[model samples]
Target: MVDDEDLIAERTPLPDAIGGRLREQLVFLAEVDKLKTVLRQSPLAAADRRENDAEHSWHLALMVSVLAEHSDEPIDVGRTVELVVLHDLVEIYAGDTPLYDDAGRESQQEREEAAADRLFGLLPADQAARFRGLWDEFESRGSPEARFAKAVDRVQPLLLNWLARGGTWRTPGVTADTVRARKAVIGEASTPLWTMVQELIGEGERRGWVSPGE
Candidate 1:
């Protein structure tokens, strides 16, 4: 139900932006600006409005840089940060699928792969391949940096939920057991962070911010 005013600005002439590879890069940047409007289920700390994909990516990069020391294995902090940045850029087109949305999860892979193809193709060929490689690395979580990046990615929502007094924890059908099961991957990257996440869930349950048990 978006009105004309709510629509994103029309893509017009490049104006004075320039041309060639720089123009392609500019177009890609402009396209990803839509990520700022693609909202996620998680609320911001203020609890006023839900956070968007761009903000989420930015936060993940910052958290990865700041918390690299907590990784279970040594990771290239710079590489992990780049992974986080590229990870959600696809959501600019595929949209943010909430972690608990079973219906959405069914088609998530297909939709996102298409998005990656189209969006990353906006860049020059070499840059597109490199960016797509980084995105795939993050998705695979095979590398140490990817694993640690994922750990922080999972933890950020938990922190937001705790801070916002339930946040998505209060969503129907979300419970302590579910939270723990989904978040168990955190331990694969950082033992201490996983322990802290468990503490937060325990406290959340006691405070009635999260459902108890399953």
Candidate 2:
């Protein structure tokens, strides 16, 4: 009988045989398939299981398209969508670092930078540079699109937690104050969304879904 390793070897093309940009594109696509396996801390709204990076990225992309009007400034929706998707591709290698993990946050940038180099390097040079550029834009939050992308990234989990009745907010030491502090950047992208966030926090505290404060 053929063993699993042998089957995998048969399915994977020899590097020398991958002769063109299309081949490189195929290889990079295969590599990013691993993103589906990278689980995140937030639970799904419609499911009992936690979400994965691929799902989170897709969700953020859709949010950008649907909520572009809410942005504090006009944004390029297409560019914002690109930022959301490229932003988390690094997590395929670096893994999801929870927002409240102090120890994890300390090394998060270093780990993600390394992951970006290795992961994006799988693509052809031009494609790699394009992907890396968008990823950096998302990280730096320098442009209007980038800031709005960052805002939606934080908002997704907040919406999920509120909907899930204290999702990650139930983590030890998390309070309404903590959520507000971390998520305040959402205001930088959209004043209306920020107001909505405040309303949600008030409601969450009243319903005992989140702690009042420290």
Candidate 3:
């Protein structure tokens, strides 16, 4: 075996700043482990249950295809698409908070904020801030782009629950009134989408595709 002095002479060292950034990147990678856990636990279909952040981003991008015609104003299709995709990147940290959980929302927000720092910190600075701004814009839901993105985000799950065999709401544990409350708000973004939601809820309920409590 080599002596201690010989081993020390051969050691490779990282510059301090470089090593620190590498540690930060590794921390960001840890969020992927949590995603594997979340996807396996289904709020929607087991097959459709994407890892929380992935699903949110996917459906929002899809909004452009599904929702373009219904926009009241001329939406910048490119900008709105970007908003949806970036909006939920923070779910990588905060986990998916179901919309109806009014009581737990405040607590969830705090956890999500912490998760944001660790997850976004992985990116080079400019990109991280750009994404963080998109997340903030989506949350505020004040602008035309933000409002549309929020609307589509809300619609994706509703459609998924209705479309998936035994969609989450179709089970006995959830209620029809819950459906009304949830989809009712979709009207804020698109009147046509809101109408489509009301009809689908009725069809699902009457056909016994959805259960009583649901």
Candidate 4:
């Protein structure tokens, strides 16, 4: 269990002239503010604008809280939320790679590893270690929390694309087979959620919002 006092301690404000661990924490916070400017390919459910990295992370965190019960394995909801929220912070520098971009994915891990070093290194030593651990765990998909967080991350964009009538799915190279291949990991975490994903994809295809499989 996480200590409530540790959470409080982490949140306590630092003085303006502080020049040690507190300064590092503040710098990390300021640096992460750029995540709000990194736009993703998916559009918002109710708006014309694309969702940004910060908003995408926030949404996934909330989804983890609300959808934890759907996980096939028991999970720590709070830890899952933390994983989801922190998973994409590296994208502020690495940029959001489109899900189906095979060329971009070839170098995505290398780019993100560099981004993680710079971004997480902005924190004090201990805090940087903890943040990197969370980020790495999410990337590895090794834990139940990581698996569920990843499932939600994938589902959120699928949901948005369905609602937005194909949204980015209408891009030239996107196809049903490619989407299914990319999203198959969701099934490993939650069959229920994966079922919903398939249903949405089927409906989108029927509506001409998603390209039919070849």
Candidate 5:
């Protein structure tokens, strides 16, 4: 009988025009293209919906450029940008789960981990491992880059809530305290950004766009 390994190798012919790795890359990109439909922070946009994953990823890349100067510590900015871009790609499979939804957050963590495995698994082993590591690192928020990325992630939603949608705080039943609790992490990361967020939230309260603490 033929050896299993040898038989498998012989049967698995590579693509003609490009290497198997590049073929796998094309497949991965084609899969990720669906990110154009995965929406985040619903109803917060004046134009089209807040943004689908493709736009969200692009916005995160732009964030690295604008927010780099505010990093509390030195970071590998290129790596940080990579982290931001890859951070939400898993949401394509898992969907956009909000921080305020505690039940959803827990479920999302498991779903996203699985999504990362499949999505990043497309690359050759080394590149896959590196990208997956960045995704995990950003999720953990342990390193300076991850923390900075988290801060920006939080900032973006708040900006959309207030600036983009003309203080969406008016959404019924949302309290100032609830918003503050949701935003407390940004406060921990960068005081300046947190200060701006606070002012925006306060303005919403003053305008009766949102209710005071319960």
Candidate 6:
């Protein structure tokens, strides 16, 4: 009779024939599939279900394509797309933190940094370094591409909140001031987009979807 190790090996043959880089890439790809199951706080645009990190990353990448022109400083749109796509990958392990959770925000960086170390480490060394750099750049929000990516990230949830008639904003303790404080950086990237978001926030307030100032 076949032993347990033999049975396990038979069920999942090692990809020894593939080149080392390709094998590592495949492993990284399969590992990141967990991102799809990492639920976020924001609801979907078309459905009541909460969005996942993978979906959020895809949406932010698409936003970079369409909104790059609006960035206050000229930016490499491709780099911006890359930054946005990889920014939240750490969330696959760190889990999504609510924007308004003050206690969570205090420890968020530490948690996400650890998550980045683990998740990005799954890739081959060079690729892992590149991805970790992208994640750090996005966190820093210093480069034009990073700033643009951050603006798009902030805008997405605001748009979803508007679409859902205040969606997560309807939660207790969330106020117009809280949103403005949290998303103020968006104006630095695109005043026009910030203007649009402010208008939406006003509309939400008018409709009683968003609470008044704290």
What is residue 127's positional error in candidate 3, in angstroms? 2.6
Q: Per-residue lDDT tens digits of candidate 6, residues 1-214?
A: 2132422233565567875877667766766777899988898989869999899999999999998889889999889999998888788678889898888999999999998997777678999999999999999997999988899999999999888888889888889888888999999889889999888888888899989975
Relative to the true structure, candidate 4 reaches a TM of: 0.91
lDDT tens readout by residue for model 1, 1-214: 1122432322465766487899778777777888888999999997599999889999999999889999999999999999998999898778889988889999999999898998888789999999999998888898999999999999998899998999998889989998998899899999999999999999999999989995
Each prediction's TM-score versus the true structure: 0.92, 0.92, 0.72, 0.91, 0.85, 0.92
Pull out the clashing pairs in model 5.
none
Model 4 residue 211 distance off true place after TM-score fit, in angstroms: 1.1
Q: What value does the lDDT take at residue 87 in candidate 4?
A: 87
Candidate 6 Cα outliers beyond 4 Å, as residue runs: 1-13
- Write one digit per residue (lDDT tens) for candidate 4, span 7-58: 3234665666788887777767766887899999999998889999999999
Q: What is the lDDT of residue 30 in candidate 4?
A: 65
Quote the positional error of residue 170 for candidate 5 in Å: 4.8
Against the reference, the lDDT scores of all candidates come to 0.88, 0.88, 0.65, 0.87, 0.75, 0.85
Cα RMSD of all models vs. native, in order, equals 3.7, 4.1, 7.8, 6.2, 6.0, 4.6
Per-residue lDDT of candidate 3, residues 1-214 (tens digit): 2132322222443346564555444444443444434441224555644436566566669877667779765677787898887666566556677665556676987877776775666655776687777777777877777777777877787777666743666544556667777666568778888888888777777777666542
Cα shift from native, residue 124, model 1 (Å):
0.4
For model 4, where is the 10-residue window of minimal lDDT?
1-10
Shift of residue 169 alpha carbon in model 1, Å: 0.7
* Per-candidate total of colliding backbone pairs: 0, 0, 2, 0, 0, 0
Ten residues in sequence with the least summed lDDT for candidate 3? 1-10
Error of 2 at 77 (Å): 0.5
